[model samples]
Target: MQLANKTIVVTGAGGGIGRELCLQLVQRGANVAGVDINLATLDETGRLAGVGRDRFAGFQLDITDGEKVSSLPAEVLAHFGVVDGLINNAGIIQPFKLVNDLSMDAINRVMAVNFYGTLYLTKAFLPHLLERPEAHIANVSSMGGFLPVPGQTVYGAAKAAVKLLTEGLYAELKDTNVKVTVIFPGAIATNIMQNSGLDVPNADAGSDSQFKTLSARQAADQMLAGIEKNQFRVVIGQDARAMDKLYRLNPKYAADLIQKKMRSLLR
Candidate 1:
C-alpha cells in the first residue's frame, strides 16, 4: 500500500491529526481528498499542504450524515480519478462529566461522530477501495478505547466500537485487496476541545502529572507508516503503547490506573 500517486480520502481534515495526515500524504505523492465540516479550515489544510488542486481537494461535509458520506466516493473519484485508501479520522469527545451526570443527547452525539461516522465512511468507500489492486483503510480509535477514562465514558465506548469494527474488517478483508489498520492514539497536542465546542482547561490544574502527548504531525506520520506496512494495529505515542501492553496483561489494573489519574478531571 505505497502512497505515492495514490488517491486517499481523509475525514476531519480541517484540524489536528487529520490536517497533518493530509499534509504528509501529499508529501508522499498521494492525491488527497480532505473532508471536514469546516470549509475554511479545510482550505487552510490545503494551503498548508502546499499542493495545487491537482494533488489536493477539500470537501465540506458532515461525516455523520449517511447520505453525504455515501456521495463522497464519487466526488473524490471525479476529482482524483481513483481511490486507493480511506482514513476515518473525524471524532469528538464527551463533555468532561460522569456518565450518570451526562445527558443522553451528549452521549448519542459522541457515538454518532466517533462510531457511526467512521462506519458510514468506511462502508461508502470500501467498494471503491476493493476495486484497486492494493488498497488500505485506517481508522483512528483512541487510547480511551482500551483504557477507561472516568470523564469520557461514552467517548471511550464509541472508539472501542471503532476498534472492534476495524479489527473485524481486517478479518473479513484478509483475502481481499483491501487492507485494514486500526490506530490507538494517546493524548496529542491539538485543539480537539475547541473543535468539539468545549472550553480548554489548564494543563496543570488536575492532580495527575500531565502525560507526555504526541504532536499531531507525529501521530499522522505513524498512521501513514502503519498503512504503508499494512499493519493490523498501530498505537501512537508512548503513553498509548504502554497502556496497550498494560491492558493486555491486566485490564482491571489498566482501567483502575486511568481512573485514578483522570477522575479529578471529571466534572
Candidate 2:
C-alpha cells in the first residue's frame, strides 16, 4: 500500500517496535494516530513522529479494553478524518515460566492484550478501512508464535493466536480493497523483555548471532515493504526467516531443534 497521504493508526506506539513504526510511517508521508496505554510513552512517540500537529497525534488507550477499543474508530475519524491502515502492534509478555508454573492471571493478561486486543481493534476498524480504496492491516506476531518457547508458553500462545487470526483475516479479505499482513519478527533488540517484567541478562547475546535479531527500524522497514507488496505474511530478521523455513519443512523437528539451541542462551 502506498503510505503517502494515508492515515494509519498504530497501537503500542509508546515504545519498542510500535514507536519505530510511527517514525517510519511519518517518514513515508503517512499521517499517524499513535495509541498506547502509557501516556508518557505516547508523548515520546508523538515527538518522534515529528509530523505537524495536523498529521501526527497520540491517543492513550489500552487495546484490551473492548469498550474503549470499540469507541476508537470515531476518535480516529475525528483526528485524521479517515482511517486507511492499522498496525496491531500493542502487546505484552508475561513472566517467563513453564505452563504448569505460570499463574492463571498472567496467562489471562497475556491473552487479553496480545490476542483479544488485536481482535478487538481489528474488528472495530475493519468497516472504516473497507471504505478506503487501498487500506492495510498489519498484525505483529513473533517467531515464538510459530516455534514455541518452553518458558514463554503463554506469550507464545497469545502470539500464535495473532498469527492465525491475521491469516484468517487475510483469507477472508482476499476480495476486498483492504490488504492484510502478518509480521513474524525474530528476536529484535527491544525492551520487550524488560517490559515483560523479567530481567534480561546478556540481552545482546542474540544481537550479532548468525541468526541475528533485527533492530526495530529494520523490522518496520520490512513491514512497509510487505504492505507495498500486499504480502499475506512477512518474516523479519535472519532467525525469523530460518525458523519459518524449518517449521514449514518439519514442524515437530523444528520445535525440538530450536529448543535445544536456545536453551543454552537462558543459562
Candidate 3:
C-alpha cells in the first residue's frame, strides 16, 4: 500500500529504527501516530520528523497495558481521523543470560513486550485498518526469532512468537484489503541494549563485534519498503539473509555456528 495520505501508527517511536520509521512515514506524506513509553523521546521524534502537528502525533503508553491499548484506536482516530497501517515496532531484549539463570520476571517482560505488546497493538488497530480501502500491518521480528542465539533464549522465543503471529495474521487477512508483513532484522546499530538495561560489550553497537551491523536508518528504510510493497516477509541485512538461507539448508550447523559466535555474550 502507498504511504502517501495514509495514517499510520508506529510503536517504539522514541528512538532507533522506530524513530526513523516515524520520520520517514511522515516525510512520505503519511500522518503518523507515534506511540512510545517515553513522552520526551516520542516528542523528540516528532521534532525530528520535520512535519507539522497535523502530520504527526505522539502518544505515551506502555503497549502491554491492554486497557490502554484497546482505547488507543479512539485516541488515534481523534487525531488522524482514520488509521491505515500499524507497525508493531516497540520491543526490548532480554539480558544476556541463559534462561536457566534468568528470572521469571525477565522471561515475562520479554514475552509481554515483544509478543503480547505486538498482539495488543494489532488487535486494537486491526478493525480500523480493515475499514480502510487498503491497509498494512508490519511486525518486526528478529533473526534470533528464526535462528537460536545462545544467551537470549527467551528473547528468541518471544520474537519467534511474533514471527508466527505476523504470519498467521497474513494468512487470516489474505482475502481482505489489509496486508501483513513480518520483518526479520539481523543486527542493527541501536541502543536496544542500553534500553533493555544490559551493558554488555558488543551486544549492540561497538567497534568490537562479531558481525557487521546495519544502521537504524538503513533498517527502517527497508522496513518501510516492505510495507509499501505489501511484502509477506522481509529479511533485512546481509547477516539475517545469510542466516536465513543457512538455517534453511542446515539448522544444526546454523545453530552450532550461532552458539559459538554468540557464546561470548553470555560471559
The 0-to-1 C-alpha lDDT of every candidate, in the order given, reads 0.91, 0.87, 0.92
Identify the superior model by lDDT, candidate 2 or candidate 3.
3
Window of ten residues with lowest summed lDDT in model 3: 202-211
lDDT of 1 by residue, 1-267 (tens): 999999999999999999999999999999999999999999999999997999999999998899988998888888888999999999999888898999999998899999999999999999988899999999999999988888889999999999999999999999999999999999788889988888776443333445577799999999999999999999998888988999999999998888777745763
- Model 3, TM vs. native: 0.96
Measured by TM-score, how close is model 2 to the native structure? 0.94
Worst 10 residues of 1 by lDDT: 202-211
TM-score, every prediction: 0.97, 0.94, 0.96
* Whole-model alpha-carbon lDDT for candidate 2: 0.87
The residue ranges of model 1 lying beyond 4 angstroms of the native Cα positions read 202-211
Which model is ahead, 1 or 2, in terms of lDDT? 1
| lDDT of candidate 3 over 1-267, digit per residue (tens) | 999999999999999999999998987899999999999999999999887889999999999999999999999998878999999999999988898999999999999999999999999999888889999999999999999998889999999999999999999999999999999999888889887877766643223545578999999999999889999999999889999999999999999988877756677
Q: All predictions: root-mean-square deviation over Cα?
A: 1.4, 1.8, 1.6
Arrange candidates, best lDDT first: 3, 1, 2
